[model samples]
Target: MKISTLITAAIALAATCPATAQETKTVKLRILETSDVHGSFFPYDFIERRDAKGSLARVSSYVNRLRQEYGDNVILLDNGDILQGQPTCYYYNYVATDKRNIVSDILNYMRYDAATFGNHDVETGHSVYDKWIGEMNAPVLGANIIDTATGKPYVKPYTIIERDGVKIAVIGMLTPAIPSWLGEKLWKGLRFDGIEKSAKEWIARLRETERPDVVVGLFHSGWNGGIENADYTEDETENTAKNVDGFDILFFGHDHHARKAVVKNAAGREVLCLDPSCNAVNIADAEVEITLRDGKVAEKKITGEVRDICNEPVDSAYMAHFAKEIDEIKGFINAPIGELADTIYTRDSFFGNSAFTDLIHNLQLAITNADVSFNAPLQFNTKLNKGKILMSDMFKLYKFENNICVLRMTGEEIKNYLEMSYALWTNQMKSPDDHIMLIDERNTGDMQKFGFKNFTFNFDSAAGIDYEVDVTKPEGKKVKILRMSDGKRFNAKKWYRVVMNSYRANGGGELLTRGAGIAKEELPGRTEYESKLDMRHYLAEKIKSEGTIYAKPNKNWRFVPEKWTNPALERDRKLIFKR
Candidate 1:
């Protein structure tokens, strides 16, 4: 063959062969996430019945600003708790039913890419949340929530999003403590598996099956601060990043805190984790860069931070969008139901039995006719002024959705319960400077400002029983029950019906299991009855029936040792009330 012929043949072969693809430029993808919005779809607080600081309107403004600047490669996500809390969702959930739920409509309008279910979302009952699942335009991912029928995830396990030829996989998981906080009926037909285990299994599966370039875990949980609980931590976002591999970023919720940090994953690669504070108060902004070589991902980088929406103005367009519905909800929540004969405040309840807590106790006893009532000031610092009581006051009084639960307990069991509660409530009066509230400011953090070392919601007190909590005594010996309200001597052997909320009955605060020494498994069986309606609803009806209420403390319980407690009370009052 001629030399020219050989050259022509070589050129033809080169033309026919596939060319190697090479990177031309780097691609920047932005991700925006909102967690634990808790039904704050609008800026208006339905309970307060006024415009508020945090809402989707403000978030919308922030998102709009980003879109205007970044040009729409932004992926938006919600980490659940959207179906409960706030009066907006409550009206939609139970009152007027719309074909397209307002929450679904709002999130759809916001253009959420994906979301997960939180424990409170599940608490809205299957019918309510199922509606959200059906109406949502985005994928609701939950790798650990198993459907009992099929033994597979009740929702989509994970979703892969491709942007500009870059494949990004987002996996979602809920905290496994659902059963511990909510009733079985609320989460019926579903099981929440461990976060770490689910992340491990799904990471391997996604790597093998999807083989995406970037993986993100959208967790409806908290950052556990390197804390471990059995196999899975309570808010296992941090732990999952530490123990699991293949995740590039993690977004957390359910604890209502704003935080951002980087942790080393199992592969020793940096994983960016962020939690936007709840109620639309904040948002997480994560920027990811993908470097490509030969048209394949060579390196990836993620930087994340939380942005405050407090200063941002409410999006006028969003406010105008939901104006009509907001007005209707306002009317319902603001209507006066009855009158408050006297003013009551929660600040007095912390020091001793006061009119604030006794009102709840009286309502519980009158409704259930139980021998005794166990009550707590759900509102940490709220006041119901004398005069007309509006429906909004009900929400202020009881912050959670709890049903009245009646349980059978003996005198000794009740005393044990009180002892455990007081131990947590008051510190031993060993010295004069003991800081009467049992607060360790360093360890308790900002929680001290709420007038308790722990969550003020868990500070339980009893009614219908005469007792004294001697802070001078040790933990086990602090509580001394004098007698029952009916002049009967408290008998240890006789079983007495006690009234409390379903949360405690179902081991919510651990008072029953840890304090009363009842096995966790036996809590459901010990419940004699449960209110058909929530306690809030009952309170409303009671007020409506009476027309006017004279709220007063029964004075059944007090702190002993007047010498120490009186002075301590005055000091603590100044500390808490700043009066």
Candidate 2:
């Protein structure tokens, strides 16, 4: 039967049913949300160079089936980060001459109702956004993102949908930290206003003008915070660090954590908020029942559940088709361009090591031939194994499609970058009495300790450079340059080439990338080249060449212990790294 016919019949049946006998007119609004997708349309992982869990085909089947059952009552909304990650992004940016636009195909299939902007989404710059937004079936909304040139919101703040005689208002908001966190170039002339102020204003307008029976907030602002001076508080219910004065339900993204909670506004009214974990790892299903009296909603009840997508059975046909596609792309995904023997973890505390971080530093060194290399640890979704690593694995490791670039920096400029990175560590260390102080005792009073240090090491190179960071001294004071692996100290007067992602090269991480001290040179290759290289293909080639693989640690980097180590270190170590 046609979808229109199905929708018509469902609406008629719902209307004919006796409202009083049923206690409430039952309308099932199935909300299917995907946030921070970062262009993983298929189930493949670029770093692992193999098919991992999570496929858009499978997600499509689930969404389509639900929509068929509930008709117009079902809304599919993506919470942003649809761009970047995977070969899809790489192909669009580099190889695909026509700009095949992979996301367009997925959106056409899902028929998304709306989406919010994510930090990564802005990294592509405004031109790419304008092109993609024009192709999207749904509207991209964020009331606070103003185009400085026009002094107007980049997208509508909210949109109202009439589903089964009920008006549902969906509002969107991006994180306010876009400028500070992502850098000024990507944002350029854009200005991000406070989310609370934008939401309150839009909510009042939505209520006064549209009078929506239910108001739902679709936000990429992420859960509240544990970080100091964080704008948003970590509230399970509202998800906004600031209070949510309006909106009955809120769906949050970013932070990559799942939570369900109830939040109260200034008026002391309760609100429901839900956030699902990243990847296609989990899905949140929210069903709200609104009771109406004399054409107005008298009361409302909400029922929500989060389902593990990986645990669910995949549609056989969809899986088969995806498997075939993987086969075609196998050469690209499985190529064994690199090897590893030890597991790599991205999360770092005072003591733990990060293989991913080490790999990126190595890549920077190799690519730029710089005396010292530096990179920030990316919070990827999962861990990597010690054997034949594929491109797919790298894709999951750094999902953002950041381009790699080389920059020439003086010794003083390098010191400044170290200072910024050090700030993150000092800020994280909460108590002074803590053991494992960031700075070493010998270098405590040296003003030069306020600068950068460097060393070299051999760890898994997800990107392929090698460097070491001395964690014994206070953050800014600890970076020491041992040897460039090639035996070179970056010259302050003469230019030194340092490889970094375009985002970092452009000073994306609030890193100093401009002025007399720094000069940038763009590399023709894609920033996420390793990730988009087709890990499956790489892995297949690895097996063809060698049977098994081993990853060894490059011990060039070491840390000095301080007095403030976590007391629960032993227990916590088992809990964190025992996979």
Model 1 gets an lDDT of: 0.83
Candidate 2 regions exceeding 4 Å error are 1-26, 44-46, 49-51, 97-100, 181-189, 226-242, 316-331, 334-363, 377-399, 405-499, 505-556, 561-575
For all predicted structures, in order, the TM-scores are: 0.93, 0.70
Error of 1 at 368 (Å): 0.4
* Candidate 1, 18-63: lDDT as tens digits: 6545434477888989988887878777775567778888999888
List the global CA lDDT of all models: 0.83, 0.58
Candidate 2 global lDDT: 0.58
For candidate 2, the 10 contiguous residues with the lowest summed lDDT are 451-460
Instruction: Name the 10 consecutive residues with the lowest summed lDDT in model 1.
Output: 442-451
Backbone collision tally, model 2: 69
lDDT of 2 by residue, 434-461 (tens): 3332334433222212111210110112
